[model samples]
Target: MDQPITRRDFLNGIAIGATAAAASGPLLAASMPDPAARALPGASPLPPAAQDAFGYYPPLLTGLRGSHPGSFEDAHALRDSHTWPTATDTGQEYDLIIVGGGISGLAAAHFYRAQAKTESRILILDNHDDFGGHAKRNEFNLDGHLNILNGGTLEIDSPRPYGPIAANLLTTLGVDVPKLIKTTQNLEFYQSLGLQSGVFFDRETFGADKLSVGLERGPLKELLAQAPLSAAARAAIVQIQEGNIDYLPGLSSDEKKQRLSRMSYEAFLRDVVHVEPAVLNFYYARTMGEWGVGTDAVSALDCWGIGLPGFQGMNLAKGSIRRMGFTPAGYEDTGGSFRLHFPDGNATIARLLVRNLIPSAVPGSSAEDVVTARVNYAQLDRDAAPVRVRLNSIAIRARHIGDPKSADQVEVTYLRGGQAFTTRARGVVLAGYNMMIPYLCPELPAAQKDALHKLVKTPLVYTSVALRNRQAFDTLKVHRVYAPGSFHTYFHLNPHVHVGRYESPKSVNDPILVHMVRTPCKRGLPEHEQNRAGRAELLATSFETFERNIREQLGRTLAAGGFDPARDITAITVNRWPHGYAPEYNPLFDPDVPEAERPHVVGRARFGRIAIANSDSGGAAYTDTAIDQGHRAVVELLQG
Candidate 1:
């Protein structure tokens, strides 16, 4: 990190809630020392109200989040290969118990309550300190002004439009997508200041470090002169971006798509278009923002569908095409392609769901006011409420009390703060990671367990940076910078979104929040192979390592803009998810089979009274899919 980062700064300025000193692994044996006994240095620096909280306000907490030190130890223990102990029966029971207090889990409770009796008791358990699952929110208080940005899952976009189930639920939650886009988001705010998107060529990749602003806006020949690129590479990029030559001239649209699906964008660009080797590197990370992988892994069809360069002349009919890696790019497993997000991403939808489920938890009647409403986390899991969301709880074992075919109740055991507690529910919804479900419910059929184990999620990170000022960005006339060689593939000023009591910082001299995205993966590996490798890499990495990389990356990208990392950067919140984006089937790494025979479908089959719910169950990573799966799980359990 920068030299200004000191032990005192870590303790005071950075709100890192690492908590437990012990590594995130299986629970310690009863005779072993308590994990809590080995707390990280200054673990309790934050206010007491935020730790192990019902009043857990994680947005205010910064630094290490999303699989933070204390969050995943219990789940890790279950994943490390043994069913945790279920000795202590809490003697508490619910009509319905939903594992994973994410969007799908919360939605399951909502649907369960609506269909079941009015008094039906529902319990939602989540391992993280906050709800919303991957729909995370990051908040910063800069110079007395509160700024909010998305920590994960930006925008309600899918290749296909939203389905009925997902769309109706959004309406029920009072989230008017079009109205919110108009009233809240100012997409042209930065453009109004003559600021445009730019590409930063790092010194390592290219011969020289350079940030070429207003790409393709002016003469490509002139822009290429300033970029750090060889003459051949520069000429190739210009041709790829602007030339209107039909690469697949003789083939029909469907034939071209079929051919594209079988090959990668890199293959198409290299073998077919015959671009220079350096040109390949330029387009490598282009798909990283959407697919979380390089052009080498993503199919040419999927890349073309999501508007990448080099396809302008292909003239392929604009439609959903099969992808070899994953179908997240253009499928409608969840919601539609709205192209707008709440300031804090889908966290607003989660908050709205919570507000609707438990009126007092979030005090707002409309969607607009919910943005700035102070969540009373204490009111979330009230014993008296029909719906309760419990955080910092990891469900370890979920098994039927008797024969699966005729069981009346399911017993659930979970770990929190290193202690185990058991409870029971008439029906259960497993809305957590599909890969972990097999570990949670061992009594499940062997084939089902095997299928669930195949669901490996992509690991990614969304880093929120609080800058002392965005004057550097203003001076550079850059709204967003795509750094192909940096630790973060993309970094841009926070979207101009303000709702009700919330307002965005408009001054360049004022501190601002910047959002950066990183998807760690090996280039040559298959989609799932990259995901698994990235997962290992993320779990083994430290906050300090992340900080150092982030500092070095931002410094190199914006130094010419007069940005000084040590002085201008105020705070950083790295939301790291080792088991991020729910597993979406990729044809490249998966068996070619019918939709019903797919692993996710076969795995999600209802087991007696226990049904699966999550974006994983639907085989798509979107908020809409999460909602649809939750609704399906509830209907299956209630009507079964």
Candidate 2:
């Protein structure tokens, strides 16, 4: 007899609840505009200039940046209301229903096919406008030539270390590791062109805009010499680099480890390392890029783990300190080698998978040709296809059809274009995110739900700016610049890559895309709280603000190199991921617990007719983790 809640009412309730929650705290009240609000309007016409010669307008370029409006609205409403409108039965059924269309989700479909050994019906439902979730491709056309760059999920680092399942998946997808290595960045070429690592200190942070290059000779000494710091601070840095630690006379290995884990890197730098405020400021942004938090929040052990120098007289291995240099050990040994990249980064992997799953969706036969193949979006969800990928469809509710003990089927209800549709599946894979799983499947155990919520995703921004030419970068004699105090922590000209028909910029006058990376983390906050704060800040940021920051930062830092922000800059695409990186073990906060006892491990346990698959579930952000988890989820679903 109760009236079903309308979608409008559900959305309104979410807005009202958010308003009430915001009213309770100033920080919450200051949160940015709903990302959905900034999405391109449904009726708006696409600008002709926005479309390239390839007839594609990259989503990041067209104002619809992050998660689309319909996607976020449905997910937010379902999470808030704890209910949904009655779903209209679509009379469609599948052997497997994967909730996300990211690397994990696509890999799930691949694994499911392999496990079943049959062309079973499978559906991949994604909320994004494009199929590849974070492994997105950003294509730019300059004077009729298309330049492709990755909007997210850039590289496959050392694929040799990947698990068996992941390695198998890559092999199955026609990804040749040896070929990828051969086609990756030509670091020797860059070095030959006077390209070297440099650091830029902003005027606001250092009293003067200064650029220091060639830090590999003596990173700490060179940095301190050029950095705006007191004589005492400079002396302290040099002393630390040279292994002078009279502060800690004698401490046992156990005692040192315990102390380092408990104490923050900032405290260790100021109190133990005896560095000044300016030194801490320089390190803040650098640390955030790696650990998603500043030195004040990250433990000293974690800082050391990522090769940040500070520890001395702790009997830390000599190789550890040497490895923390400007070039690092593995990188320098291999001439700065990065593995597995297409012209558009890892998006090629996703494209390859899509092509294999639904051969009609893309016109390509090999990895080389996939780079330039045109995707047939219209054919993604054909009824006749054994595998279907449905984009812009957000899965809201997933629940068991009957008793968990005997139920052989699960029902997934998703929202698309303001309409709710239901479909049945023999098995389900929750591959979107760890935290969202609890809300999507409320029938899960309370402990599992709590554990699922505990895994917080790190927020990040990977902004790709298309430049008119690389004159400024060439003039600066650097391909990469580390800006510790700028809005963007690091900016670099994407390394030249030649694969198939696509070739990165070869000449200085050629148009190029500069990749900028930023991780937003609040200092002095707990890890999870810092992630939450960062997410809030990411959602609040507008494209206009991002553009302004990019323009100002680039102009100020690259002025000496003959860079003009207005004339040289052609396009800007900000890939703002509120939930960017997967949850990794925090040495500072997370206890040294067994693998089976970890929250992600327990949270990912298979429930009735459903299994979890994602990088988060595996507790690592690597592409291999996603593939491995996908294989595990499909295997678990099949065995049960």
Candidate 3:
């Protein structure tokens, strides 16, 4: 649906940081499980293999879980006396106080502690109980594979080199970067994640009449070429061996960087690679699921930046791990085996960081020293910052105009429990999305906010649908990529699909989850009005609606492939993300923003002491980007 309607009868109806209600009729009851126990069912279980494959590890099946801000600070107070300078003599007035405990916030915490081993008072305040903001981790115990599953920021690719900040972390963590470059391991990694997909072309040449087995080819050959492509396809499996893809036109220059920034991603692919229309659509669907932007809206610059430097037209690697038919034995790190992750994506990292920041209170302390410990998603309603954490805390502002010499010292404010609360800090790092900037800094110059708004990321809604013990495509291979108009993401999970298949148990009769992410219209009245027709039609797709769709698709595929329907189908679980995906498709580069445009915000800044940070700001909205921004924010603060 264009706008996912809030439902009352849907499974665990609208998780508002509370117990979920059951759906109207369900064959199997799936309750939220502990974070430590829920893991991604298919592809790589062990940490080593985890890095090599693409897909979320430790599936985020439910709401957030971990330490809250209040308790965390109290623990620090008791652990170090200087932390609390007030009458209580606890760690309160920190040398460095960070607001908004998202990925960037946590990464800042990690960087500060790691850089300066000397226990400098550091306090991190997040409205949410869990650290990662958009990067949420969920846990569910359904059939057998029960561990922390990732709900957002699913995977990281290698073609895009890590920025300085992320590279620094990799060095600090001592991850073997070279391993990811190799091919044998990378190919196996692709197979493990069911990335064994390809663009089916009707003709050997670039533009063909027929596509996807029987679908008629659209007349938009030029448009279709500008779609997303797999690394191998873009390089034409040729440029990698030559290593000169970066010399393409519209590249190697800063001014013209935005040259490809205006057109749709599909347009860029067609203009660059001159590939077949069918292959373009296949790759386009994968990109849509990954970036939440369709070919039409996504910018060519973003497409180029996100993809390998040049070689714009290409298909994703499939079956085997040959980028361009070359055995990238030396480029292991680019392959699947080099992926690094926590059991539950980066949420594990957030937990570790949160633990280090909080004071370690004694197990059985008295009521006086007990410092009330409350961790709930709704704590923000109680002005919970005074108490503890509110799960869904959204930050609105952070800035420091009074002290231009050091913008580090700042004021910040955020909304918790649906109410606004402000805090003061020595430094503030805004790590939220760019669109959120307008709301946080309401007084910001219209031009700046509007320009940033132009960089709005395509909005997306992800629905994780699980079908239990129903093998409709038994005859077909377990993994296969679908064409456009069909569900964007669908793959088998458990026994047959996971990495380390030999060691991991299989489930012929167990439930397998299929994750489907669709593009949703942007927020605000304009988008809603524009998408009213689609919204009405899509609103009917409840868990049952999804089940019926899958059954319909499965019936067609199975009938063609030859498989039993009734005996194979089992149960289903549907998880929805309404306000997901960043809004910017192609970002505009405005190097200099006027000072007047930067206004004091309610939650964004507090007397140059607190700042905000999230992918909501500019730059690629990834875990690494958040980390880089965190480091930049801290550096700015320390300088002041």
Candidate 4:
């Protein structure tokens, strides 16, 4: 009379036995979509109102943007109720099951194949509709011509400093460093095109919507000379530009370093340097683009590390002045240029990895050709393929099949098109964001779960706008401008790199892409708390709000340049990432723990057939870190 003991029932029995409670009906009903309706053609993965007319993915019409509602609802419901559907085993098995389809997970598949020395059956599942994760590419067809811009993960910084494993991975992926160097745009050439650094002060924030160019000689210095500021503030500005710091006395070199490392840059500028409020205001907005927080959240040492004018102790000579350069330390410009990049940024790397792992998904032989390759999305998860990537599939649960020591297989359950499905694998890799791991695998040790939770992802928004021409930018005589107190912190013309078949725009009238960056960090909050508040703000923002902000900011700033936002701006794509940058060491908040005792190192220890891989696992946000972590995870699983 009882139902037969299928795998799904058995798993459900195990879950129910573990926690003596049934699945909540309302939660399950709220999370699950109508399966019958979802099967229809062109049915949106999100609610109808959330889909934008032009933008990719659901636009988060009312809720969060990056990690939107549907992506987290089911997982949250399961976690809260301590119940999930009995995973219906599809009877499919793989040699490896990767929990993310980002660069790290893709690299894990590559490393696993190399270790086995054979083409292994691997499955990669991602919650997003598209692959590449944060290395996103936005393409537009304007006036019958293709315009591409990077949505995130812009470049491979300082490839020479890469570790042996990372360098070898780059070589294996067919990245020609010499060829890339040759193709990258020269900075001097950009400056020749009347593109130079400038700053814009909004009327609301600085009492005037004024644009200042040529800070060294022309309007900027004159404006500072005549603007509202005390004599001490003006002197401090000059001292900062000239790298002269004589204010703090009676301190040894080590003592000065320790003081700077402990104090906030804002505090150092106001308290130590004795700068006025206006000067502190100017300094606050300087580092938002790179650090995701203002000067207050970052320490004085970080300010100096990013080439900000603060570490006068390093340049003790009275006549010597440290320039306000953008380049980070140890990454000086090679031949007066930063690094090479593709037209669509590092998305080319993701494309190359996909081509190698699943040859049928893309058609490309080298990195150069990958820029224009057409991917066959329909073939990604085909049954016949040895390696497959399944998009719009969110993994909700992962567990060992039997005893931890003796279990030979791991099972993973995920949601696809509103339905739940399960698959088995010889090994599993958790290569997604660190915060979500605790909810996915509740069986992890309490300390490991707590350590994983300690990682807080920085939130950022990268918006690209397609324009009819570059006349406005040229008229303004500035290609890049930093907006200190606006919704968008920075805006610039796309990098002019002519590589492969893609050619950079030549004429001023040619359609060009304008990229804007914004990192949401609330002031007066601790590092982790600020990240949490920023994530909430990002989620609460709507597409309409974003569009409105963009229009107002551009129109006001470019009005003097004869720019009409309504006529020139053709399209806008806002790529909101709630979990953008990976967690790194914070001098103010994080303890000076040894490498062996760090949370990331302890949490990443291999557990049975499962291993961890991601930028967060390595405590750095570089592309090489992701690759190294992937390699380590694969090696760990093989040895275990």
lDDT by residue (1-640, candidate 4, tens digit) is 0111110010000000011111111111012222232232343233321111223222112112235455656655765765655666778899999998778999999999989866789999888766777877777666777677777777775312677887787789898777777865453555777666666666665667677654533544454665444567767776766655555677755456567667888998889887887787766766565567778877776566545775654532211111211122223222121355677777777888899898876786887778777676655666677888877788988889997678999999987656678889999999998778888788889999998988888887888777899998888777776667667767878777766677668789998988787777887788888889887887787766666677777777777888887777777777788888787677767876777767788778788899999988987766777888999999999996
Clashing pairs in 2: 32-540
Model 2 lDDT vs. the true structure? Answer: 0.71
Higher-lDDT candidate of 1 and 2: 1
Looking at model 1, the pairs that clash are 26-77, 54-377, 159-330, 162-335, 162-336, 325-586, 334-624, 334-625
lDDT of predicted model 4 = 0.69
Model 4 RMSD to the real structure? 12.1
Candidate 3 vs 4: which has more lDDT: 4
Candidate 2 local lDDT, residue 263: 76
RMSD of each: 7.8, 10.2, 14.0, 12.1
Q: Worst 10-residue stretch by lDDT in candidate 1?
A: 5-14
Arrange candidates by lDDT, descending.
Answer: 1, 2, 4, 3
lDDT of each: 0.77, 0.71, 0.39, 0.69
Give the winner by TM-score: 1 or 4: 1
Best by TM-score: 1
Q: Candidate 3's C-alpha lDDT?
A: 0.39
**Where does the lowest 10-residue lDDT sum fall in candidate 3?**
6-15
Work out the TM-score per prediction.
0.90, 0.85, 0.56, 0.86
